[model samples]
Target: MDPTFLSAVQLAALVRGGKIGALELLDHFIGRAERLDSRINAIVVRDFDRARQRARALDNQADKSAPLFGVPATVKESFDVAGLPTTRGHAALKDATVRVSTLPVRRLEAAGAVIFGKTNVPVDLADWQSYNPVYGVTSNPWSTAHTPGGSSGGSAAALAAGLTGFEMGTDIGGSIRVPAHFCGVFGHKPSWGLLPNYGDPATSSAAGTDIACLGPMSRSAADLQAGLEILAGPDPDETALTLNLPAPRATALKGLRAAVWADQAGIAADPETTAAMLALADALEREGAIVSRSARPALDPLDAYHLYLKLLDAAWSGRLTEETLASRRRDLARLKDSDQSADAVMLRMTDVPHRLWLGLNEQRFRLRRAWTAFFREWDVLLCPAFATAALPHRQDGNTWERRITVGGREIAYNDLLFWPGLTGGYHLPATVAPIAATQAGLPLGVQIAGPIHGDRTTIGAAALIEQALGGFKPPPGW
Candidate 1:
């Protein structure tokens, strides 16, 4: 087997057993990536020589204290890696100076992980599919005709293609998990604020923002947990910072309570997707999990999602040119007759009064409380990762207006948000479990969510379910 195709855990075991040197493992992946990355366009920048040097250094020390010791991984282009161009997929940044590494990246490096290359992302990290003029588009390993979800698409695609063993990706809205789903890989969107978002090269000129988070995308759930353990916590110099997350109980799944809402009123899942989720539910029930088919973890997720969108818009609003703002003002004025004017939408959020923002936070608080209560009875919740399987690359400028077929029905492009928004809006922890392949051979995943701080249960349950239903299958061509 190719060393590059080994799971992070498996690779770690090899390193411990002296079956392969870390530098030798690095060479295996580097050689493969050099040859194959051109086809997928998953890697944006190459740091092969430097990565080899670091791998050799780690081999000299061979310390086992670091959880990720000697493991090779990639960072999304959006994250800074001091001295590497942090071109969040923008051509204008090609010649820009590299910024310092983010805390997440720093933690990974501190843990003895070799920082390889940066993966491609959509321009400005706004799109769900990774593509930009700088690095071209990243294709799904399963089918080049389809896309690996983005802006972490490159990371997901690279992992799926065996170009890299693991990667660090950012998730504000399905950026991490969606790509993982599309690529038939593993991803974890941690509880909001669990991982630091600092170290963005784009924010080098400005202070860091917190709406987004940095997480791990890998081939197995355990790797996500390992990365999270390395990256989760407050920054240094904080007078009082303590993070003590609990490990999952060793209890069997037979009696575990699970609330399932595979279908939602907001969006329709594809026939194959629906079937897959149902199959997973059945599997869990047979495994001793007390599946609750009646209860659905409900929130006005649409409204919460809208709020998240508004805040996200505000975060990026500063980058809007003056001319765009002027046009938006006119658009807002004309939208007076309608409730949702594009201009008013952007302007209203930018100028959201303290009271209004407070009210929004209160609503978010209430929703979190409701979920907290729901989790009290249910050990886990199962949902869809996206409305459809990986679709053909879309060039349309409006992701919201895009449409996809699900269950032989047409669904608005934004309908994908309904499922992702459910967990993201509350900053809860969720894992994507690959259960089956679509008729077209695309992978379909079910997003398993657990209460905030219940990251262990979410991942633990996924591991059990993955074992029950056969786990990852090697891509046909790979």
Candidate 2:
């Protein structure tokens, strides 16, 4: 059987049944990556020797009940893998090595996964495109001209190209879901603090930044569930704490309650994307699921977006240098009260006083409460993952000045944050599943969002959608 397209769960079953050797499976992925990765530029850092040794060791073990036993996978470059560079696409940090593996990496390894390499990312993981001085641009497997989507771009590209069985990626501002949407794969952003962040230098010391999450990315929803099971738990240092996420609300699609939000008043999604999302809603209705198009959480969309932007900027403000902080303060001082652009919001929110931050933090809690109340009546909230499909590589240097054409109108490059931020800002669990393709044949995806700690519910809905529409079609000639 061709191993390239096999899901992680399928691969593990084959290995455990002795239908295929663990070492042989690893070699198969390695060979395929070596042969095809040059075109996609996804697996930027290879660990072939270590992966082979680990696979051989696994082959000698008698027990193979681990969920991910002998599976070959890759993680986003930002993750710390002992002896590998966690540059996060920064040129200066390219040579820096991490001596200890991150918590997620250790957990995956403990689950019998052989992580053979790290995928690429945007510089500082800031942009929507993956390119840095260290690793060149990561191209979409469906079309080399278009990007795979940033931050976790390489993770999605590799999966779409069948170069890896599974991936783990960090999402702060749609990092995981956007890539999955663009590349026609599956990705999950777990509830806040559901997965440990220990050893990830970006959030290693960040205690209050609840917006960022680490979760699984794969070609199948089943793989996502398996990956999350292996990674979710309390951090090692917090031994007294335990997690017991509830099972999905329902196992089947029948009698499910779904809300569809295709386009918000301020955010204009492409017609193709909107059509695809509405079509999915129609499909669900046909399957006996009660689907609503007008249901909302009673929170104003623009107000929610503004709150999300402020909190997001505050979460990342620690990374700003003193000089940058001073400059931003100057920019804020010059801003008029009417200025509500994303840049203005970021400037005003960055380096906020502790008291002001507390107020915004409280506001965020209120938003989370509103979402929680809304979810009580709905099983899943379906929306477009992004405004458009995978776009052509636009590495024109200044991202702040970059513009994306959505529905014939140009908008700020960062506008892509709205949909993901809706769930991300409030610490909700969201899963991205490909549902259709654009006229150009590029992939389009929808987001399945659930209440806080509703990771299983969202993933279950995504799995049902995937089963109904089919999932993870490989790029032609891959």
Candidate 3:
């Protein structure tokens, strides 16, 4: 096997068994980045000098039994790595230095992984395409003409192209899952608050943000599981509390209950994306897994989406600039009472009053109860991670003003937020795993979602699907 395509666990084992030196493994990836990164532009913030120092120290150490022993990895650019600028691709924050490493980074380091560099992200970490003023753009290894997916776009790209042994990324919307789907990797969008994020650009304080989660993204499902164990835990201050996430319910496809919602009525999900999902369902059924295409949560999809837009916006409302808030107010003023478009609802959520926010919270809890009931009968719900695969480089304007074609009809680009928001809004854990590719050869993945705190179940299902489907094929010429 190529050393570049080996899983983080495999790399660590090689180092511990003296088959490969820690520093040598780190340098192999560093050399690949130096020679090939211009094409994908994934690792935007280089810290190779410091990474080599750590790798050399690991090689010199006598005890090499750590979980991630000597594995080389990178995190999303928004994570705080002390002395590295935690810029989310904004030019203004180009010089703002991160004084402390984030909880995820510290934990990864504690597991004996060498943190090399930070990946690229969009400005404010808002868009799906990973392009911003600071890092330019990251192209998919599958197709440089298209995106790798964002705001964790570069994380997925680096993992897919074999530039890094592992990666950690955040997912509020589809940041982690979308990139995994586009790049044909495994990404786990953990249950909210399962992983503490201390140094994210938006949540620099001791407190973490709502609706957002810090999790792992990698080319292998086992790597995703290992990375999650390294990344998921308490904040430094929350050491008094014990962490006990649930274990996997099923490791094999037999006797597992899976509900799939690949395409919905009135929603313009691309047929190719849905077809990949259906194929996975068929494979699961063939393996004795109970697969259903009709099981759905009791809550309405549109209502969940509208509520999701508000709550999603509320999570980031505090970071909104006066200019941006003013733009939202202007957008709100032009909206009609019956206008429930994703853009309209999100714009209306700017500075939501406390009383109204409380009402929304009540509604969200009720919807969450309904989802819990639904998940009680199903082990996982597989769905389309995105309406389409890696989109063509679309950096023209902000997200709402953009449009995407689905099934020959044009729709609001943000409208595709249904799948991600529907589950993530209520804080369900979802793991994305590659199943097959489109006729055009673009990779396609299915989102395996389970109930809140069911991270293990989702990730386990992903591992089984990975085994059944021959996971994570490297893109041609990578």
lDDT digits (tens) for residues 1-478 of candidate 3: 4699888989999999999999999999999999999999999999999999999999999999998999999999999999889878889888878777887888999999999999999988898899998889899999999999999999999999999999999998899999999999989999888888886544386666789988999878898888888877777676867678888889789999999998988788788888878888888999999999999999888888889989998988878889988988888888898866688788888767899999998999999999999989999999999888889899878899997898787888888788899899999999999988888889999999999989999999999988888998988997
- Give a tens-digit lDDT track for model 2, residues 1-478: 9989889999999999999999999999999998989998999999999999999999999999999999999999988999888887778877888888888899999998999999999988887799998999999999999999988999999999999988999898999999999999999999988898788554355363558899999989999999889999888776877778989986878888999998888786789999998999999999989999999997988899889988888888877789988877887788899966676677777667899989999988998889989999998899988888998998896676677789877787777788988889999999999999998989999999998888999999999998889988988999
Each candidate structure's count of clashing pairs: 3, 0, 0
Assess every candidate by TM-score. 0.93, 0.97, 0.98
Q: Candidate 3: global Cα-lDDT?
A: 0.89
lDDT of 1 at 454: 85
Which residue runs does candidate 2 get wrong by more than 4 Å? 200-203, 206-208, 333-337
Global Cα lDDT for candidate 1: 0.79
Q: Which residue pairs in candidate 1 have backbone atoms (N, alpha carbon, C) closer than 3 angstroms, thus clashing?
A: 128-150, 254-288, 402-413
lDDT of 2 at 360: 91
Local distance difference test values of all predictions, in order = 0.79, 0.89, 0.89
Regarding TM-score, does 1 or 3 come out ahead?
3
Return whichever of 1 and 3 wins on lDDT. 3
Q: Give the TM-score ranking, best first.
A: 3, 2, 1
